[model samples]
Target chain A: MTNTSQDRILEVKTLWHYYGNTPALRGIDLEARRGEFVTLLGPSGSGKSTLLRILAGLELPTDVNVMTLDGQDVSNIPANRRNVSTVFQHYGLFPHLNVRENVEYGLRARKVPAADRRERALKMLEQVQLSDFAERPIARLSGGQKQRVAIARSLVLEPVILLLDEPLGALDEKLRIDMQVELLELQRRLEMTFIYVTHSQEEALTMSDRILLMNDGDIVQTGTPEDMFDRPNSRFSASFMGVENLFDAKVVAVSDAGLTVEVNGASIEGVWTGASLPSVGETICCGFRSERVQIADDSTTSMNSLEGKLTSHIYKGKYLDLTYQTALGPIRMRSWQSHAAPTETARIAWHKDQTILCPKS
Target chain B: MFRPPTHVAPASYMSFVLIWGLVALLPTAGLLLWSTLTMENFQIVWEPSLQAYRDVLSSGRWQVTIRTLEIAAIVTLIEILLAVPFALWLAKGTKSAGVRTVSLALLTIPFFLSLSSRTIVWRGVLGLNGPINAALLQLGIIQEPLDWLLFSQFSVILGLIGPYFPTMVFPLYLAFMLIDDEVLAASKDLGASPAFTFWNVIVPLGLPGLGAGIVFTFVPMIGDPVVPELLGGGNVVVLSASVQSLLRILNYTVASALSVLMLVILVAMISLVAAITARFAKGGL
Candidate 1:
């Protein structure tokens, strides 16, 4: 999101970071408008966390040409000096202090008046719905409560941006869902920039206005969840977003009408889902989500269809996770368990535009 | 523990910890009893009199008591103030354990040598013909060798610092090590300067250990004979030396009373300081 009248809340140009001699983050350029909930989505060691730390000024970047906050340069500022706060994993709530005192820590550090600090801390505690536990020692709070206190503490400082490093990672399944809802609500209400770091694809998809997928210290793709899952730009992005069926195919022809690709010996016509179609004879990775394919009777199946023997199938409540041995390779698909009986030759079909084609990883 | 550690037997370990204390403390209890007894006229009779207590109170042993308190208070204060920062550096400055071990070993090298040898070394270092005087003379920083460096209150204070400084460091280092680095980093992230972090986080967190160090240094220093006897060299007469000299002349009654009084005062002073520290900490940071 951008506005002509307002400057970017945070802007980074050509950022690089290294741990010792090994590069943790390769050159990265990024800009965030005010109130954008950007998710840094990647697996472990993918440099997502490192990038977030650099943005928060917790770690110094190896080199940065333009690191600014609200159009002001903040390259040399420390974490304490920068107008950003973080809700670190494990909560990082000071155990020796009560909830109220812990919430007021930043205010106290800035030498805010005693009365103002206490009143503000109380107000923040109430906002997090922990007013009753203001005087309670942090050790006594439950995991979810601790997380809320941490969020409240970070927000009370009124930072320009808040970085959350898997804040709900420690919670149980039920609590995580609840916190996810609460956090998204908070992010919307606060109207401040948020850089959320998480490896959970579901979390990244659910909360992010835009997801920046990272791999091997490089950002692979940046798009909305729909764009990522439906039409990924790279094989890494496609597979990382949970594509179960991938096949190597050579393009036979490309036109405005559609593109045809030859897989093994079968020519499959599929609408080109990517922005630019591939040239004839070029090899590309064809990926499809398991749930996107449709299994049909061989007699009525149309284009983008393949005939294969059913290898195996797994009953997974709402859908049957089935694999078929086709001429190209074994391809997996999610079929409703009620329609599938284990032993039969089957025809699997999908729409022309459902094929996600990308360059090889 | 998820699984109990097999090697340690709580029964045996607890007895070793508790039984030794009992065995050591029986003598003090006996001394307290003996302090109330006196030999009447020429007869060896069990007659409890306030005479020895009165003599202890009247013979100006209170001066020795006050002097012992002054020295203990000064030594404990300086040792803690110095040791906490050094211990913090050892525990947090570097991630390497080897550095801490080597530094601690170097700090306590004086303890490896006998106390007498260490005291003798201090004497040499601070003496008129000592290395310090020679260096100063050679550099022409002073025309005369400093006389008060050795055999003065200064020497007593200086002498106790080196040997007892480690006592403060050991406990404080343990406490600081117990603090999670995340907690400290979080403090700094929340805009606390280093000094504020130390006061608001490190001090309260490390207080119990520091309080123990204070006991370790102060309790012993209050009645310490070696420092006042050897290093002080008659320029200072602390309570311990007073107790020793009283015994030398067969003044057993007065000696016993003096020892008991010093013990009581030391315990009371330690308790008072502990109470103050506890109150000031307000449970924790």
Candidate 2:
């Protein structure tokens, strides 16, 4: 968390909120500098949506927390009065309003002159490429068009921070991907700080400048996409960041070579990058990506090679998805090309850097 | 929850239509037949005559028809104005199932007791020496008990509204409850005040219920003669009251004519309501 400084557009500290007796956000500390696209990434029930609602002033937060926008404390400001907007997951398009009217709502609320409001709304419509369908009723518009209208509605307001609560979650995977690119482009072009909440880990990795990964009402990690994907600090963080090859390994020793972790009576050394590496005789998790695993040389003296029996190979066009069965567990790898059939001997290796070490949960 | 209909025999469909015809259409035909009959020189006549129609259409009877419609329209308007806000509160204010069920039970208590008893209760409440006058007297709001409170048009309206308002309330509550909380929240989030949201979102959403409630309360108020009989004190003459008085004096032909006229007016008003509802519904209001 950062203080309310000159460059920061929004600052939050020690924010605790509750729904009845249930804690929705516990000790949340976050800051968004000017034009920063921060993502609140978490699974369902992790309170990411709750946090977004509180930030948007839709839900009054319950706590002695400090929240500021542009160096002014706005913790108690009502949603309409606050200089913030939101795009709900369903787009929250008014079914009675046409696309133009929906986009013109905020400006009208702010008492903008009718002529200027109409011109600006039309310009915003053109910006979102919805000018051609401006008069279409919301019920007649497709889902993607509604989404663009929602975006245009908020962008026309030019709020300090736009809180998006999984606005693209309702779209299909293909459309969702396309919208992700469009959203990132819109964010960059407008230079607006967007505090977007979503459970999709890939979306956070692809779109965010800084991702605040949350779990069970607690922020687990906050980092850039690569910082989180490459240097996840815990078992939950590693798996949530899309590293799937986590395994229980007992620490045998730590030395100049690396930390030696014994897995199923096989000693495999891994490079530990975290501060205060685990001591000897402690159990921790070792993880690596499926794409990082390769066929081991089988004769190398490195401490990262393991032999297993091939269970199956799925042809994925660009990559061969192989599952190898070993005494430890199933080790999956996505090789560039198919090697052999299932139920065959296989040896796989990953570099020391790719072999991730995480605390056992 | 519904299974696909494998097949419905044509015989069953024909029976359904036949049953509908027997239940709904036969009575209208009967009314049409009765309205044209003649009462010749104080004796029943089989010949079709326009005398009953002429008697009913006389200027004297027009007063009764207009008064009947006015009272029903007033009651329906008052009920609508009262029921919508009450229904909104009942649906949205309390989330407890027990409270909603108890409130609904309380609303239905007027239905169980006879309409005549309900008129008696209103008489007690609106009478000169009743609780209303007593409270007003004790509060120094009035020096004497109000004279026009009981046995008047006000008492008749009060009597009918007690038993009929729930019909308006229940359906309107269902309509208000159908609006998702998110929709209202979205309206507020879009910079609409609570009053604006109620006018723009809640009223538009509840239009069908408004139409339904109007039909529910209006038809019975216009048709019922008991309330006016007990509360009118011979001062008010509604169409139904006129029809009742006409029938008691062996004016069966005139009575049937008045009844037919009331039925036609009700059907016309209902058609108008249906037209307005259909138009707004099509507009997606």
**Clash statistics: count for each candidate:** 0, 0
**Residue A157 in model 2: shift from native, Å?**
2.0
Q: Write the per-residue lDDT of candidate 2 for residues A1-361, one digit (tens) a residue.
A: 4544766988889988887898888999988988899999998999998888888888878983689988888888878777888888988776666788778877776778989989999999999999899888888987888899988988888888888989998999899999999999999999989999999889999999999999988898899999888988788988888887888889998887678888888767777745578999888988888988888765666537778888888888777888888766898988886654444787777787668777865
- lDDT of each residue in A187-216, candidate 1, tens digit only: 999898999999998999999988999999
TM-score of each: 0.89, 0.89
Off by over 4 Å in 2: A1-4, A254-258, A271-276, A298-303, A311-321, A338-343, B1-19, B29-38, B42-54, B57-60, B137-143, B233-235, B250-253, B275-285
Candidate 1 total steric clashes: 0
| Candidate topping lDDT | 1
After superposition on all C-alphas, the RMSD of every candidate to the true structure, in Å, is 3.6, 3.5
Q: Kindly state the fnat score of candidate 2.
A: 0.29
Question: What lDDT would each prediction earn against the true structure?
Answer: 0.84, 0.83
| Model 1: DockQ vs. true structure | 0.53
lDDT of 2 at B254: 81
TM-score result, candidate 2: 0.89
DockQ of each: 0.53, 0.41
